[model samples]
Target: MADYTTAARPYAKAVFELAQETSQFDSWSGRLQFWAALVSHPDMSERLAAPGLTHQDRATMIEKVVGDEMDEHSRNFIRLLSENNRLPLLPDIAAIYEELRAEAEGEIEATVTSAFELTDSQRDSIIGALSRRLERNVRIVNVVDKDLIGGAIIRAGDLVIDGSLRGRVENMERAVVN
Candidate 1:
């Protein structure tokens, strides 16, 4: 059997494509979140997993909760998942869909950990630098880690820049030992 992510990828891609074509990115995100939350709830999850309930019955239960909140596209998407017994993968599907959406929009989320809190000017400066370096619009989340001693460590997707004093010390120590 395949992992849940493997099961989820196609669904995510389909939803993402539809959302992109229709410019309904936020709406799609909301719809995926609703079904994902519904199916992942403790009570609803047990009911959904009950061997006695037919697939159609489980689907109906979901529709009743979703009612009037979503549009036709979202409703149809949920029905498809139910018929295929893929309801349990909704949360994973939503997450991957969001990642695809963000990638398509050329947005990157970064976290910078510094020894002290950054002023607004400092944060703005870092964002500007990262945007230029990555060539993508950067969204920053700041963190304070005193163990850094000074400077900061930046993490963006697969890229990590370690400018922390502690990191430098470790690198230097390794070089001397080598």
Candidate 2:
């Protein structure tokens, strides 16, 4: 079987393109989030998975769960998924849709782990540096790890800058071993 992400990609791209064309990123994002959550609930998951229920019946039940929040586009999307028996991919579709939206907006999320909690000024400095380095707007997520032993590790997408004392010591150990 193909991976769920692979199967869900085209659907996510379709929804993303539609959302982009209609200038409805926020709307589609919210709708996807809601449907994903609804599909993920254990009780609803069981009902959707029930082999006894026909596709239309399952779709109707799922639509009712969504209530009035679903506009026509949402209703049609759900109906299409139900008819195709692709409803199980809702969560992956939502996540991929968000990633598409984020990429379109030219944003990346970054995280920094340090030996101690970062002060406001310190965080600002890091974001500034990352923005300059990456040449895009940078959002920072800060984490404290006392074991880092007095410095930080920065992760910005594929780029990782390990400046921690622990990291340096590990590198030194590797150098001696080599």
Candidate 3:
């Protein structure tokens, strides 16, 4: 599959700059998310892939569905994507836009996968540790995987810490084999 992030970066940066200039970051975030979800729907994807629809036709269909939710600037953005055949990159654009937004706001989202759900105190402790280590506000998303057996695996951006029992056991097995 093609890597859409490289193509989506320019669009995401442009939109982010516009949002920053206008102090409309939240507004643009919502708009991008809505458009991304719409375009990512299976039905919409199928329709968009169908032949014979002109770029204008595709943009108009999306605009009609979006209705009053989109302002003039947003509609124009959609048109530009349609004209450039970049409509399918909306998801990547939105995701990149969010990452930009988070960076600007000095925040990072982390995910913790564990054998069991974390208690409120445990969650708070993890958040505190990550915040202190990263020197940024941290938000965690918890995922439970029983196969982990114990402990947890924490992922924050490029950093991943695998403290799960399953991971430790695997490492020990590898060491023994070697």
Candidate 4:
């Protein structure tokens, strides 16, 4: 797939700045997510790609569907995207906007993949450790993967801690081979 993230960055940053200036982070976040989902729908995607619809028609259709949910500024933003043929980039923009929002709020989301489900105490412990280490509010997303055999692999931003039993065995195997 084409990398839309690079093209979406400027738009995401612009929206993030606007949200910050207006203290509307949550509102914009929700709007972007909604728009992304709307545009990503198979029917909507097909309609958008259809040659019969002019940019104005596409924008109008979206506006009608959104109705009063969009404020003047949001409506203008949507129009700008339509004019630039960037409506398809909403998912990337929303994702990047969320990253900016999380950074601004001093929060980070972590994914923990393990062989078994984590107990409440274990989850709490992982959250506490990650919060302390990262010096930011940490949100944990737990995923169970039987392939891990045991233990867990924690990922937060660029940092990864691979403590899975499968990982250890692989390391040992590699060491013995080399």
Error of 2 at 57 (Å): 2.5
lDDT of each: 0.90, 0.90, 0.94, 0.95
Candidate with better TM-score, 3 vs 4:
4
1 or 4, greater by TM-score = 4
Instruction: List CA RMSD, all candidates.
Output: 2.5, 2.3, 1.4, 1.1
| Cα-based lDDT at residue 151, candidate 1 | 91
TM-score of each: 0.85, 0.87, 0.94, 0.96
Clashes of each: 0, 0, 0, 0
RMSD of 2: 2.3
What tens digits encode model 4's per-residue C-alpha lDDT throughout 1-178?
3578988999999999999999999999999999999999999989888998888998998999899888998989999999999999999999999999999999999999999999999999999999999999999999999999999999999999999999999999999999
- Which structure among the candidates has the greatest TM-score? 4
Q: Write the per-residue lDDT of candidate 2 for residues 1-178, one digit (tens) a residue.
A: 3599998999999999999999999999998988899898999999899888888897899778778777888888998899888898999999999878877898778889999989999989998998888887888888989999989999987999999999999999999999
For residues 92-170, could you state the per-residue lDDT of candidate 1 as single tens digits?
A: 9998998888789999889999999989998899899989999988888999999999999999888999999999999
Worst 10 residues of 1 by lDDT: 66-75
Q: Would you give me the overall lDDT of model 1?
A: 0.90
Off by over 4 Å in 4: none
Comparing 1 with 4 on lDDT, the higher-scoring candidate is 4
